[model samples]
Target: MDRSKRRFVQALGATAAMASLSVSALAARRTTWDLLIVGAGTAGLPAAIFAAGRGRHVLLVDAAPQIGGTMHLSSGQMSAAGTRLQRSQGIIDTPQEHFDDLMRISRGTIDQTIARLAVGEAAETFDWLMSVGFEPLAGHPVSGLAHEPYSKPRYYWGARGARSILEALGPLVDRGVAAGRIDLLLEHRVVELTTSRRGAVTGVAAQDAGGARRELRARNVLLTAGGYASNAAMFEKLSGIPKFVDHSYAYSQGQGLELGESVGGYVRGAEKYLANFGVILASEAQPAPLLARADFYPERRPPWEIYVNAHGRRFIREDMQSVDAREQSLRLQPLMRHWVVFDQSVAERAPPLIVDWEKEDMLAAFDSGAAYFYKADSIDALAGAAGLPPRELAATIEAYNYGVQTGNDFLGRRHLPVPLAKPPFYAIRHQGVSITSTAGLAVDGELRVIRRDGAPVDNLYAAGEILGSGATQGQAFCGGMMVTPAITFGRLLGQRL
Candidate 1:
């Protein structure tokens, strides 16, 4: 070993000795592992399984009391080209085409190397899912869902949100452990790294659930510890943006980001923070919900009326077909905040404003002023009570009425190609909210974590949301991008790295 490696080994030894001394008068013992995988979530579990299959002694540790990580809450949509299942189903696709679609949608923001690695190897990993009896939602592996449409039918989702993906992998993990190829240490949190003087990782010092410190040496370490979305302070510090809401996995506290940085891995992908549009019913002051979502994505239910701001003016092409188009338009506004303004005519004839609310609940919202409802004889009085400038709202209503009479509109809104001429007008406040962050850690094509100085930290790797959605999806959420890339990259790391 070189001088640096020797120093790292010695330092680790001393730390272990100190830990033992602090605990009791017991002698220090050493445990060695061919591969030490941190986290037992979506990415880490597969790594453990694949490494164990290679006959390597593996130690899998997680901070959570259980496994499954963020996969427990994710939508778990997957994408690929030329999957074996697709071949058998008479579907045709190529990785090259998949690569082209990602680039075209991302508009060159994604790292080409990582994108290529993921797209090129995606189908095989997807095929592996089939070998394990992984099933998809009926009518899935279609062209796309809500985001940009795919060039070919390459997207698939599990039946239940993310559980379907986890169920398929759980049996494989159990098999690995039964064969003695893998040892799992749950409720164990890695605190610090034991490194050699040359900065090579020698081992990690961790505290178990019972608060006992232990040291273990390993030849390599893989960090699949999701992201910092659940950690507000770290999320703000790393991405320069405050946590908008707490809808992500609670265990995603960004422990891996801290651990990686402590060992000389610098952060990347912070530049890709993009929030999705139309997160309904969130208050301006806090995260989480004070009210449930209004479910305004017109594709789910055709928009019955126009949406507006607090000023009661139309702000978008209400008939636009693309969710991406709508979300991107919302992102351009401040805080993604807006309001849905309609009238009594819409209230009576249009679909319910809220998904499950009945006439009674809707009336209650109006009575309590939780939602805006004004019974004014004229449009100007309605606008004033709704807190909008009377003239602007009146002019807007008049223009809308003219369109209904003339059979033509400048905005081309087909759903309510009619006027809001009625007894009362209504409005509901909303804010732009997102469950996923676009910003994430930077990785090379091989998925190795790199330092700020642009040097690869050997034997260190990261996959899944730890790398951030923004790095791969860019400013807009391309459909199937976040969950798919996460799982695809996880599979790639396990089988190859």
Candidate 2:
């Protein structure tokens, strides 16, 4: 679907939307709103609902036509200790434990005050989600999946992933709209946060689809607009890392960070540059989002083929139990890149290595002569074709085959079911990819946008990735930290602000 027309407009209730601005509302559009919530996604929607239900006239605007922002693509996994879901599952956990695990995952390089705030409030948000008909995936509330595992069963999402959370939120938003509390400005982009002469945020200046600009006023403005993922320039500038893969939602263009920074907001946590390893780049000559990726999670699927760096030496144990350890080990490799080198025997014998992919399809990729995937008759040829050192590649295979015969693997690899013995060989090159940047607008416990001096910008609040994952998940993808902190912060702001 064309994103321009995709879910662009919120279905109108009896109450008029922003485009249809009633005469009375228009006359006061520049001054009447009590709260202006920008970017109606996970955090934005909740802030709108909770604040509007409290008798505050709200203006909810999003650049995209639809309501759910990243929900369309988000895996939507979430976690909160001591929730009703955990109680029902007979899982014992606490916010303190969650906080400790999160800090351990980030190695204490996170915003402790903000982490405390989110984890303590997350259980209430989870209970509220359940009360609103948000059902969990069967046998969910499990420890973990793609990322690191929690100590107890506290992770879950609906069958539809982010759509499940969106479903639970739709009714609450509709109720607010029906009661004339929320005036949703779908397809309207908030370009700037309008502020006062003394540097206090007063409202937002937005532009609509037809290129018309409007300065709408509100007593309180939520800086929940967009993250930096979709904007390459800002992403590189703030993240200090080139976008190796373009997998973020297109709407996450960092408009919120831009607007906030245009004022007094500054970014932080850039030192936490962590990479998600094993992304098969779309182009071997030049880095791109994908061809596809090898899930390569030892917890889910043990390795059949070995992983080797550009030097053609094994870099990992291939069966590391901890996801964090694997990611850290990957960081030490050349540009965090490696190739999956295997022979015909492993290709036909071992289970498929990539998720949601078949062996033939992978072979087809190799046959296509894509630079990222290669098919060769010899180890030296495979190395030359896949950009690895020829001698090193051949020696690496010999060492591995020797280990396979002696039953004493060099790299502590127990999953050596197949060695590189067959004549026809294959190599799949992969570079690390990051979905979200670890750097973003730094804010305090109140969710107020802050400056470099640790001073808060009044009435200017931010949630979601706008705060950066480093603040929430730290350098590691702590289980469910993104969605959970986003909701918890937005909820906290709506209730107390």
Candidate 3:
């Protein structure tokens, strides 16, 4: 075996018995697979493991250099009711409760079919992960941390985030490969879906990274290859939002959606473009850029300052609890740009606003003369330096200060801890950037790909963000929606077939 393969095998603790499976050195057998799944990722890996365990010959193909497609990028945050972990902690939750919580958190914007399926199948998927040594971070399973909160503490993942899921799942896949129940192929991109004369999906056409072509036949095909977030053109076309700062996986090229569309499958849930507002990119790279997102969530740190648009108006109350309200409010502004304006008084009194950044670090960034950060002795100068209308910005600070003294904010903001009367003010620009696919192709609750008229495309199935997060995540990011649903649908569809 190669050096890296030996190391990987040793890390998995497989010993000599499962060394071959641990190292993916065997050529994929040229045989008809009982199940052919594109993308060995959050959804595809779970699907392959379950199907292979059921005595089916599974073929799992990925275009990346190794297994674990987007899991490398995912936070692995998942939510499920009735998990044994929840029971151990005396937490009471059910699929119906989960469904209701999701609907409520999304404000009833999520697709019911997809939501129901995910809520129903989620607990088993989560339990499976835990049974295999997948663990939530210490003192977790909270109501919510990243997005909106659920009614109960049903949200979780690992300390290493999504890698925890991969660490536990990888060896199982390796064992399947070693036992010959599954064929593993990395660096093989599925280029097209092969269909029968009657329009049933029978196989796939793939191209290796070196440009070699091969056709593989299968009884059924599953597309869990993820969304078009990494594709600038497709991301804009489908989402109607600029692919501003992409921090998603590079292999997320929307190939699955293209292949599905080639077979007459239509897209759905494109109207649900939700921006996750917090990115402060260090560079101007279009598709993929290094980003440091601010910890602006109300739960993490109450706003000691106000967020303003390019027009120099406060979008939402500084201490608003609803994360959806804050995000949508930002989405309406120009380029979804927001600038935090705070006075020296507020900065001195309040806890550090940016996560892990102390009061001194905040001053250091401003002193370094970064283009995105600006400071001035007065609001007028601060506006000019930060590219806003001096009059409007000056007026905004005046009204905010008036509210602080008068005990009544014109903007209805309840938390006016300190105002902008002090000199040497601060303002930092932030972009509302996202990496998740908000829209995607249409699919039934059973995960069958469907045409525009709702007719199921024969012998084809899909899961994960390839089905668009809109179908499950809704107009907002419900905590644990993305990863949970992807794994849920993967486990559900695999067993059904």
Candidate 4:
């Protein structure tokens, strides 16, 4: 391995070793605990910490070998109004304003009850995270980055991303384990939810890596087991789309959703599914690994190329400022995919198309015969190579050049730097995919997993991605909506239950 990779592996090993010191063996001391958290992740960690802090005997179980869940891969972006940090920075805000901004950005698709509950307690969550040594980036609390901007400067993230948040929570969990309040089980997956004859959830039946099964009892069971983005079958079944990308936590196999549904709970928000604008895939395989991301955000890099759909039609203005508008437009394209088409002059002069990639590296992709990069001496040949209609692509390029000459662009695009008239045309395939599950278990305002009749399943609650991205952010990619709500709800449930 290279030096950097070897160092990373060594650091990861050391971290796991230290974390293992805080974990209790798989032996449960009590037959019935006060609470059982089904995932020791972003939501489960806080839930276990606070629940144990309340002197509740808590059993924390996870399918993964360690804790922190999706936070391990998350950007760790968080948004909360009326935070002490915002006040200290002299920026005024409120949860009501946060709610309004979310509704505006999501176009009223979010669950109002859940959204309110999340925003209402988000400040406390952020403040607590800050008090525990979670540091935000310098000059943070900006309006936004890749998502729709909030009205106030409420967005923040740590310099080290989610690991910063995990570092803050790890010590508290160790204290809980040391005090004999929290019992943690790693490499144990909850296979079934044990229920009373009355249909109230009593506990969970978990299986270890060795397939040894054990039934533990608890008065309350909370599912913070994350989403199904990693499970292709479940992703298609729930979101009604092929899982086009393999970019989620491996343990996020929708087991929590299944466990919730098996015990009389229902799932919803399938219609609210939305994929990201687009990403370059490493291969042509279904659910391919992400190769690199193009700088589609016009603010960051004004487009010098035109984006065309499968039919070789320009779907939207390439220079559109709103990221949400771009994402929604991409959602309507064929298979949620598009191609960035440009000519030799634009390719040489435009800023690097791929984020953090050198222009020469991008040119090398075409020479190496990469799956998504296409290059040809003519537009017709390029279209054939990129799987676009030759005649339509030629016509589209002709019209685009005409617009450039006359300055009367049909799509009202303002950043038309050059025409696609130069030879050796190029196209890069971009696929729209989501890294988080959109459909989630049905839950009431109290976060209790509810039936189709809207009644809560007794002793069963859900938080985090198990509640679905749609539940909190609606049909839009609201910044920090998933992570913040997951942490906030986990905290609230931990304190209350």
Off by over 4 Å in 3: 1-28, 288-290
Which stretches of candidate 4 lie above 4 Å from their native place?
1-28
TM-score of each: 0.86, 0.93, 0.93, 0.96
Best by lDDT: 4
| Candidate 3: residue 328 lDDT (0-100) | 85
- With candidate 1 superimposed using the best TM-score fit, by how many Å does residue 317's alpha carbon deviate from the native? 0.4
Clashing pairs in 1: 8-196, 8-197, 438-470
Q: How far does residue 362 in candidate 2 sit from its true spot (Å)?
A: 1.5
For 1-497, candidate 4 gives per-residue lDDT tens digits of 23432232121222333323423343536778899999988999899889999999998888877778898889999999999999999999999999999899999999999999999999999999999989999998999967988989999999988888988887787777667788776677999999999999999999876787888899999999999999999999887889989989999999999999999998899999999999999998988999999998888889999999999999999999998999999999989999999999998899899998999999999999988999999999999999999999999998898888888889998888899888899999999999998989999999999999998999999999999999889999999999899999999999999
lDDT of 2 at 302: 80
Kindly report which residue pairs in candidate 3 clash with one another. none
- Which stretches in model 1 have alpha-carbon errors above 4 Å? 1-30, 209-211, 237-241, 282-285, 295-300, 310-312, 353-399
lDDT of each: 0.70, 0.80, 0.81, 0.89
Candidate 3 TM-score, C-alpha based: 0.93
Native RMSD of candidate 4 (Å): 3.9
| Residue 477, model 3, lDDT | 87
Give the residue spans of candidate 2 off by over 4 A.
1-30, 283-289
Error (Å) of candidate 2 at residue 355 is: 0.9
Tens-place lDDT digits, model 1, residues 259-290: 78887887777776666666554344555553
Model 2: number of backbone collisions = 5
* Lowest summed lDDT window (length 10), candidate 3: 10-19
